[model samples]
Target: MTRTRFAPSPNGPLHLGHAYAAIVAHDLARARGGTFALRIEDIDGERSRPEYVAEFFADLAWLGLQWDGDPVFQSARLGSYVHPGERLKAMGLLYPCRCTRAEIAAAATLFGPDGPIYPGTCKHKQVDPEGAAWRLDVAAAVALSGPLEWVDEIAGSQRAMPEVFGDVVLLRKDLPASYHLAATLDDAADGVTLVTRGLDLFASSHVHRLLQALLDLPVPTWHHHALLVEPDGRKLAKRRGSPSLGDRRRGGEDGPALAAALRDGRLPAGISLSRSLHTGA
Candidate 1:
């Protein structure tokens, strides 16, 4: 059976862009007579809030999205990440890095999709594992996995290039697992067959694909839909003060009607859809 998931971080209220992604994942599962799942990605210890998590459920329900089974919270699954991380460490594919963000920025001359890529400053350094962030040796990992490719429902097939992002952090200094490690493990655990989200995350699939190969987990197809942007062409984001779904609900807007409007391309004033496929690094 085909299974899809809408994993959202409970760091803020859900906005229209989030609603669009949720609705797409939910409808895709329903249309295929498959299962739809929701996962709360609340691993950010500093920013995740209980109030935001409560609002996440309320917003999804208000938007007429009923997920199968209870939501899986990433916070409770920290232990599950250790085994995979250790396996990589045993294989000499993971290394402890002590570089701070400022240090990396000072050393890096080139930037990838996610800001300045790490210059592999600690790739060969012998750092204490405790309280240190772990980075995957992208070149070594790709060599082990060989040439790999994944398919996207919208953009078609893509060759996996994990090196584009440099050595990505698999485990954070402050958290047990990074987003790349946790999300990849959770998707496999939940049996998600179709990973649905916005196109801005399209490049992330390459890293996730490599993790799947390294961990010997089941691979899933991806569907990176276009992002919903403001009139200024910036993507809607909670940090940018984008209006939340709760704000709309409190203002008496019908949730189901708004979902239908989004599906039909009748976006609200000052909001438009950017359908371009972002495959660039």
Candidate 2:
């Protein structure tokens, strides 16, 4: 079956961009006579809120998106990340790094698609901190996987170059798993065949492809859509004060109608699609 998911973080209410992404995934599944799944990415211990999670269900329901089965909560799957993490560790492709963000910024001489790439300061360090993050030795990982490539419906064929982002953290210092580790494992476990999301995450797919190879997981195709932006071309973000869909719902707007508008490219005033933020890896 062609399965796709709309995984959203429960850190804030759904905004217009999120609505667009969800509708796209839902409609794609519907078009293919497949399944549409919802996954709650609530692993951010400090920021995730129960109230926001409830709002997510209500908003998706209001949008008329019917997901298959129950939603998968990342918080409930902490232990599932252990084996893959341990597999990497066992292969000696994972290392503990105690470097702080400030220290990395000070040492980073080259920047990749995701900002300043780590300089591998602790790749060979003998000392390990109590709560150090576990980073994937990207060069070693890629060499083990040999040459890899993934296909994107929109971006065409992409060569997987995990080294672009340097050594990415597989386990965070404060959490059991990082986004790269948790998301990749969850997608494979759920049997997702088509992964769809915003173009902003296109670069992160490169890292994910490598993780799939290392963990011996089933590979999935990707479709990274353009981002919805404000009139000034700024991408909609909760931190940037982008208006939430809840507010619009409370204002008496019809959810299905709004979804149709987005599908038909009939965006409301002050909203536009932007493709200016493409990233490479």
Error (Å) of candidate 2 at residue 8 is 0.6
Candidate 1 stretches greater than 4 Å from native: none
For all predictions, the C-alpha RMSD in Å is 1.1, 1.1
Off by over 4 Å in 2: none
Estimate, for each residue in 1-281, the C-alpha lDDT of model 2 and write its tens digit. Answer: 89999999988888999999999899989999999999999989879987998888888888888999999999999999888888899998989999989999999999987788999998888856478999999999988999999999887899998878899999899887899999999999999999999988989999999999999999999988889998788889999888898888888899999988989889988989887877643
Using lDDT as the measure, the top candidate is 1
Report the lDDT of model 1 for residue 198: 90
TM values, all candidates:
0.98, 0.97
Error of 2 at 267 (Å): 1.2
Give the Cα RMSD of candidate 2: 1.1
Computed on alpha carbons, the lDDT of every model, listed in order, comes to 0.92, 0.90
* lDDT assessment of candidate 1: 0.92
